[model samples]
Target: MLDLHRLRLLRELSHRGTLAAVAEALSYSPSAISQQLAQLEHETGVPLLEKAGRRVRLTEQAEILVRHTETVLGQLERAEADLAASLREVTGLLRVAAFQTAALTLVPNAVTALARSHPGLRLRIRQIDPEQAIPTLTARDYDVVLGEEYPGQPQPRVPGVSLHRLGRDPLRLAVPDSFDAADLADLASAPWAMEPSGTSPRRWAQTVCRTAGFEPDIRFESTDMVFHASLVATGHAASLLPDLVWAATPIPGRLLTLPGSPARTLFMAVREGAHDHPAITAFHTALRTSLTTLKTTLPLPTTEADPAS
Candidate 1:
């Protein structure tokens, strides 16, 4: 019989597209991953991978195995969910992946609520970008993912995950108080600090800046939004900021609205049928309650209301 564990490795290879990525996500070495997949090939008597340049591609037999793996995994998830439902108490470990912004703002409240309400269930939260969050979730590395989508750059749907809309987070322009710009378009040439390239925030920022008629003079790149806020607050650089940045504090710098009052959707995703699991439900409820509290306590800053991202 084919080893279920090695079968999972094949599925992960299909999802991640490279051995190095799969190894990194699962905390295994590339050679180890290769050896296990080779074992599976021996058992099945088929070529599961073919060399293409410096990388590898899945063979037809591997694709067939992946389809079966998906079904087997989904069934296992349902079984686990069912078993958990049979119990009176929510117990077990739930691994969660969230980006920096949500981790700071809403995730804490969720964790607190879960700890108080379901004392037996433990949740592990890791800071990860949405770009990598969902794929890792599919690899069974994380049970839940808290993520956000920019206005135009929506994440493509991954198989075997159920997505839930959490809230809409607005993106705003952060200009230094010492800076002088009467209109939003006038700051195009100013020094800017933004999230690193290829991130959702950076993509949206570039698009909006181009539409405003100038490329940004991005002088600083950091994944930490707190740093971005600090840059603007200290009058060092202008930045594209999010509502989450000011959720726990007073407005740090002057805020400008995007052209259309654009916003990114905050979301949660879980293994397909595991949404109904007791622990997952409890976490989701806590997230909603925390979001409600944030909206009530953090009053939206008054702005002139112009067009933006």
Candidate 2:
């Protein structure tokens, strides 16, 4: 019989791209992984890997095995979900990843709600960029990931991942107190703080600026939106920030709604077959309830005459 464990290692290698990476992630030695793959080759009676420079690439046969492995893994998840549902209590560790804004604003409240409601369930969370988090999620590092989608820049679909929308948070232009900006066009030449290039936020910010007929002068680049806010607050740079940034702290400066009053969509992503898992379902409910509280407390603009109002 083919070894399911060895097949899983092959699937891991395919996703992680290197023996060293797969080893580090799964807490196994590279040589041990290689030995297992060798055994897998012996069982299959077909070569499943090839050398490509210093690295290795999967063979055509390996790719075929990986497709089947994906289906098998997904079925295993469904089995696990069924077992969990048959239990009396929702109890287990749920690892989660979230970006800074959601980490700062929504997650804590959700955690509190979960603690109160599901006392037996435990959670481990890490602040991660959605770009990095989603891949690790597919690699089985996280049970759920809280991610955001900027308007018009939908995240690409991954075969085994499922996305569930949580809510929308408004995006607005933030200007230094000394700057008088009516719209994005007014700040075309201004120094700006933005997420680094190639990130979803950076791409969306650039598109928003280009649509307004100019490219932004991104003077400061960081994944930290809090830092971006500080720069805008102290008259150093302008930025496009989301509503979640000011959920706790007061707004630092004048806020202008972006064109069309665009808002980023927040969602939770899980592996496809595990969507009905009891723990995941409970956490999703807590998150949505927390968002309800946020909606009640969020600051609303006072007047149409001033964007900052």
Candidate 3:
């Protein structure tokens, strides 16, 4: 019989595409990962991997093994879910990952709600970018991930992962009090701070600027939204800021609605079969409740009505 653990390792290698990546994600050395795959090949009596330049590619037999491994993994997830449902209470740890803004704003409230409702269940969360989080989630590093998508730029669907929409977060133009800006076009010549290129937010921001008839002068770039807000607050730059940034405080500067009053979509993601896990479902409930509670406290910024909504 093939070893299930080693089979899982093989499956991980296929998804991750490199032994080094698989090792880093799962916290193993590259040599250890290779050694395990060697053992797997010994048991299967076939070549599971072949050299392709400096990297490796899975053989047909390895692909067959990975397909079967996926089925086994899904079934195991169902069995675990069923077992948890049969228990008197939800217990054990749930690992979660979220981007910076969500981590700062919504997750704390969700944590409080979870603690009050399900004291037996424990949560472990880390701040991670959605770009890096999704692949790690597939590797079983995190049970759930909170992510966002900018307007008109829907993220591509990943296989073996299930997504649940949380809510839309309103985005507004944040300008320094010292700068006079009424709309996106007014800031065409103003220095701006935005997320780095290739990020969804950066692309959406650029599209918004282009649609307004001028390319923005992005003088600063960073992934941290709070820093972007700071730059705006201190009169260094302007930014397209999300509502979540002001969840716990007043808006730092003048906020104007973009041409269409665009909002980003937020969602939770989990493995396909683990979506029904009791702990995951409970956390999802807490997140929804927190969002509803937070929206009531969010400051209303003066903005044009959203015709598209």
TM-score of each: 0.88, 0.91, 0.93
1 or 2: which has the higher TM-score?
Answer: 2
Candidate 2: tens digits of C-alpha lDDT, residues 269-303: 99989999999999998888777688668785632
Model 1 misplaced stretches (Cα beyond 4 Å): 18-24, 29-35, 45-47, 50-56, 302-309
Worst 10 residues of 1 by lDDT: 300-309
Candidate 1 lDDT tens digits, 21-135: 8898889999999999999999999999999888899999999999999899888888999999999999999999999988998999888888899999998999988777787
Sort by TM-score, top down from the best: 3, 2, 1
Q: Best-fitting candidate, measured by TM-score?
A: 3
lDDT of each: 0.86, 0.88, 0.88
- Where is model 2 more than 4 Å wrong at Cα? 52-55, 302-309
Sorted on lDDT, highest at the top, how do the candidates line up?
A: 3, 2, 1
- Considering only N, C-alpha and C atoms within 3 Å, which residue pairs clash in candidate 3? none
Q: How displaced is residue 177 in candidate 2, in Å?
A: 2.9
Q: Give model 3's TM-score versus the native structure.
A: 0.93
Worst 10 residues of 3 by lDDT: 300-309
Over the stretch 176-295, how does candidate 3's per-residue lDDT look in tens digits? 889987777788899999999999999999988888899989999999988898888889999998888898446778888776668988899999888888999999989988876776
